[model samples]
Target: MKRLCTLVAAVLVSTSLTLRAQAEETINYITAGGIYLENIQKAYLDPVGKQLGIKWSVETNDVDTPVRVQVQSGAVTTDLVEFGASTCALGGAEGLYEKLDYSVIDNSELAPGTFSDYYVGSTIYSMVIAWNPKKVPNPPQNWADFWNVEKFPGTRSLYRNAFYVLEAALLADGVPKDKLYPLDLDRAFASLAKIKPHIKAWWASGAESQQLVREGGIDMIGMFNARAQSVISDGGSLAYTFNEGLIDFGCWSIVKGTPKKDLVMKVLAEFVKKEHQADMTLLSNYGAANTKIEETGKIPADLAPLLPTSAENYPKQIVTSAEWWAKHGAEAKERFDQFLAE
Candidate 1:
């Protein structure tokens, strides 16, 4: 009787492993969503799925709300998500993601701070000043210039979030980039007060940022580099500058409690390849997370200077401090909400 029971338990364990492996065959990816989805599909998802012999689908969704809902409800439908770097810290803290398996996913290709225990950076993107040149020939060269309405003189837009807004405020107020964090919210909000009246719209999405640029609702706007580049490529009257651009990455994190981690890790491996990363850069103008993208000889010489990680422009911007934000994001958001209301 004891031997029969032990054999039955062994069979049950074997059947569970087999079922999980079968479940890993189809992978689902969640993205922050917008113009990025098309390219991400073309450059990374479609190709990787083919190469790995796995079926794949993607959802265009808000990374934070839906992910939190899915994780907390224990109905995790997606295998992986493209998270803002700071969101990775928040999600990990909330136990929303699996700790990454480094043995399967290589980190050597990633830049410093882009790799974390639960996630790995997939693309390096920038938030910059995108403008209609007809509206303002003399561009805001830096954050200080952006705050100077009397000199540049244009309606503006900024993201609705406090992350970049606070940093820009501090930089415009003459704080050096190197000294940016443990951010002085008191001073940053004071700087924001000066330009708040000039801001035409506090955009909530990437698509809105691009629309603001293309429709000429605002003369110059704080925008994402890739969104600006997408407009520029489409012959929209848009141009962008790199100075004071906030450099951050979108990283891949497996949803906690997913049954497909093994295959999800395989997808990440393919996503970060120099070739696939280069493919994305060509499509979106986001610099590849794989640093060796330069050495891949895939990017055109003319385009090299525009990448956020490019040698010529990287020095002009500030790298956001995820560690600092991870600790203070909630407090800052609370104050920013009150400030905006007041």
Candidate 2:
């Protein structure tokens, strides 16, 4: 009887192991549409998956509709997500993101408070003014200067996105930087109206903005600093100013109903480590969310001007008001669409 019982226990243990393996067939990670995915796959997914023994698959999209639909439909396909400031707020407001229990994760190595109850910032990026130095030897220095198209004549490419561009327009029209939130809609639209035809195209994504300047197709642009950094690194004749740049960050969140929430939080904590964050920044040309990442003191001097975290640049920039923007985003988008239609 003892031998028979031992044989049955062994069979049960094998069956349990098989079931667990089958349950965690893969970890689904969703990311924003950008070149940053190249760095994320290299710096985080490949090595981290090898360490954790989980299969990793990354999917990318431009907006949050898929995530929203999945959550509302009670069919959560994405286990982990990395998204921008606006999307993070949208998820939080819509109750689509998981309430992270950080007890299983180690965030001691990250900057203080980088981890939130529902989300963790993964990287820092900024929407800043960029110019082709060759084309405009005396480039604009501030939001006021960028609006002076008659003095600095050339085709400009502005951000097509509603939030950043609206805030920027308000600033250009004399809305104090600190008072930009709860925007002045009429003046903002008027400011954009004044510059509409001067804009050759409104860039819809990072790649589009980067290509605009890299190919010397446009003279001035409001572009993400990370994309501009790549251009400068490649010896492309482009430069950017941190002044009046709208500071924004990307965050990682777990889907509210994912079975792999624990594993997703593990990846989030590991990715925020100073060393990992630094390597990711190096690869993607985007700033690490970890404030503790030590600069290796090897940043390119020309590109330094575009980096928001650089000491000289950080002081002059402004952090975007995520809450206010999120609250007003839908209405602002409608207004912008109407303005563009005119």
Candidate 3:
């Protein structure tokens, strides 16, 4: 009888250990580092980890190289990742991400056209025209005005990326908002050439743009709205306009062959909850992709108009097409680089 009792006790102990191990499974996620990742960790990952009794390990990489390496090796270590819209579309087309199981992940709360079968929009940001009001008392209201050096005269800074630069050029050339896509590359480049001589710098990062504006290195710039807001918050003598702003967003996707797809989906759904989405905006000053935040008044009234998706600002901006860019961007980039050289 004593031997039989001991055997039963050992079996119970083994079962308990197995269940605990399963419950404590850890997920690895990758994202762009800096304040964006910090905010996501604080508002989404940490809370979800506590509530769901799961563990998440995060790594930072600005590009998709790490994910590509893992997928090619047939040994994906990162279960999920966040990347720009262009990268998301390209990766999706290349089958680098899993086909999201929408049945398990509810995206009803997200903004219209924000999520796809392979990814969900994580945050929204914009590129707008920023200027030092002291230098140019009369600010340019739209892209067309921005091109009129005679009126808003000063050295300018523009993003190094071909995508935003081309779109801005098209708009400045009087391309209607509805007609901007399937972009007129020849006309866009022609327009860019007219202003190229006036441009003082081609900024490669948000920090560079901000620094140039803050130090009076450039009188006007094409820059991110969040960076401009930082200048305003610091009481700098800079101002920006949303008219003709270029709306862009980042997305979260599951790695193609992750064995933990179901678990990752659950975690993703949690991360995009209305409350957590609101928290993300508050922490990072970027717009939430969840439309419910607007209705729920989670976004403060003062900050609403500043968001790229806000009703007042939405119509004034051009929403970029990730799919179109994914298809034609390479050629456009090559042409743009050659144009710059000449």
Best candidate per TM-score, number? 3
Q: Clashes in each model (backbone N, CA, C under 3 Å)?
A: 0, 0, 0
Candidate 1, lDDT over the whole model: 0.86
- 1-342: candidate 1 lDDT, tens digit per residue: 999999999999999999978854877878866668888988987888778878777787665788888888889888889878888878887788998888888888878788888888888989998888988999888888989999999889999989898999999999998999889999999999999998888898888888887784688888888888878888999888998899888888899999888778878877878899999898888987788887778899999877998889888888898777778999999988898898
When summed lDDT is taken over every stretch of 10 residues in candidate 1, the lowest stretch is 55-64
Q: What's the C-alpha lDDT at position 188 in model 2?
A: 87
Off by over 4 Å in 1: 1-24
C-alpha lDDT score of every prediction, in listed order: 0.86, 0.79, 0.87
Top-down TM-score ranking: 3, 1, 2
All-Cα superposition RMSD per candidate: 5.3, 3.9, 3.2
Task: Give the clashing pairs for model 3.
Answer: none
What are the per-residue Cα lDDT tens digits for candidate 3 across 36-152?
778888888899989888888899876789999999999999998998888888899999999988788778888887899888988898899989988898899998988999988
User: TM-score: which is higher, 1 or 3?
Assistant: 3
Best by lDDT: 3
